[model samples]
Target: MEVVATLAGMSSSRTEALTPSQVRSARAALRALGRAGMAECDVDGQWAIRADASAEHAQSSATAYRCVHDQVVEERCEYRAGGVSQWSVQQAAELKANRAREQAWWDGLEAPERAERRRARQEEFAGLSVVEQERVKIELAERRVRAGVDEAARHDAWVDGHTMDAWVRRSIERQYRYQRLPEPLQQAKAAAWQRHRERFGIARGTPLATSRREHAAALPSTAAGRDEEFLLVDSGGRTTRRDVETG
Candidate 1:
């Protein structure tokens, strides 16, 4: 007769609910070919009892690694717990072993070989574009910042040669922060930008004009007659008004 068990309370009083720890004990009993009243069990809270079943049938789904004192056992025995597959367990074990072996091999390498490897990696990095290099630097810096090894900065002397305030001002001048900047910062940045344009003629359809228009439009209640001062002057010293379209 085939009998089964599950996490759900057993239907018959003769069957007892087994804890995860009891799985191996039950499996050992089932594997003993001549053992009487033994039940074939799996780690997935499942078991079966058969009057005509043999030890081979009981051990077919078993792993070659054994679980010892609830610790993992390596080689020729199966670790059986929590329904974890033997193949997956073996793969993890092998990966860990391989990492150790690789570390040992690397440690045994000659100084020259290690130096050459470092030089090769440096060369590969040197081949990247300036923009790509800057991106890598920012990513590394951000990682360092997250690890508390460094403080986050918008720019560094070697990276962009601009301080955070300068970067924000530049972003505003480039129209990248027209609507994004705080109202006060936007007005201050716009005033500073207007001074720059007066000193150096504001070109039509440029970031300066676009940002000014956006700033004015965003605060129409306060921008009455304020936008009139933003006039584009040509090389001939004549003022020409041009509407710069926002993208």
Candidate 2:
């Protein structure tokens, strides 16, 4: 009743159905669900929480590595409730967000860009010691078996029967070795992406994509396998890259 009166005071015609105090209480309760990521909605006694807004919000925000704002808030609440340090909670969030962005960036690349990355990465892999290379191969093969990305019969045909028919097979086989293996292996395949950014040397919270075009990296020409510094003139004719770092 008090909530109704408070709502009435705010706007008698619009909020006749609710007490301001009750609305305040409900809103307070909703805030604890801060991590639920649902934006606050005005409850004007409309059809069932404003026509399925929660479901719509969930569908709209669904994306890689994002837990919706409400969920994020809820996680922070949990951390707080459990006596976890604020720094730890913040660090975990930062790491999770960074890794997601990196994966999204990698996933968004065109086939040619991905191929070029693979070629560049292959070069990086070759720089490792022979023992390290062998270990990575073994790790990758095991990961393939566990992931069911390829069946044992396929491996048997390739490994035991030597039935590989395409040159691309080796490349695909090599890439997944690291692609599938997160530094430390995970029991569940779904959660193993934690260390995915480590493979690319991306720092935590760095975006994989950006609206700023000038910050784009130049893909090195791999044919000659040589390094050269180039000059970049921006739209405003601002000299940006001269093989140097600027603040």
Local distance difference test, each candidate: 0.48, 0.46
The sequence of per-residue lDDT tens digits that candidate 1 reaches over residues 98-173 is 6578679989999999999989988887687545655565565545444333232322222345443343334333
Local error of candidate 2 at residue 22 (angstroms): 63
**Per-residue lDDT over 1-247 for candidate 2, one digit per residue giving the tens place of the 0 to 100 score:** 3332354354355435555665776556455333344334347732122223355446655753365666678767878788666666686677667657877999999999999999998898768654565557557655544433343344334443322222223323333354445554423332332343333233332221221112322333332211221223222333445423553
Local error of candidate 1 at 24, Å?
Answer: 48
* TM-score for candidate 1: 0.21
Off by over 4 Å in 2: 1-83, 130-247
Give each prediction's root-mean-square deviation over alpha carbons: 19.8, 21.9
Worst 10 residues of 2 by lDDT: 205-214
Lowest lDDT 10-mer window, candidate 1?
1-10
Native-to-model Cα distance after best TM-score fit, residue 158 in candidate 2, in Å: 18
Cα lDDT, model 1, residue 226: 28
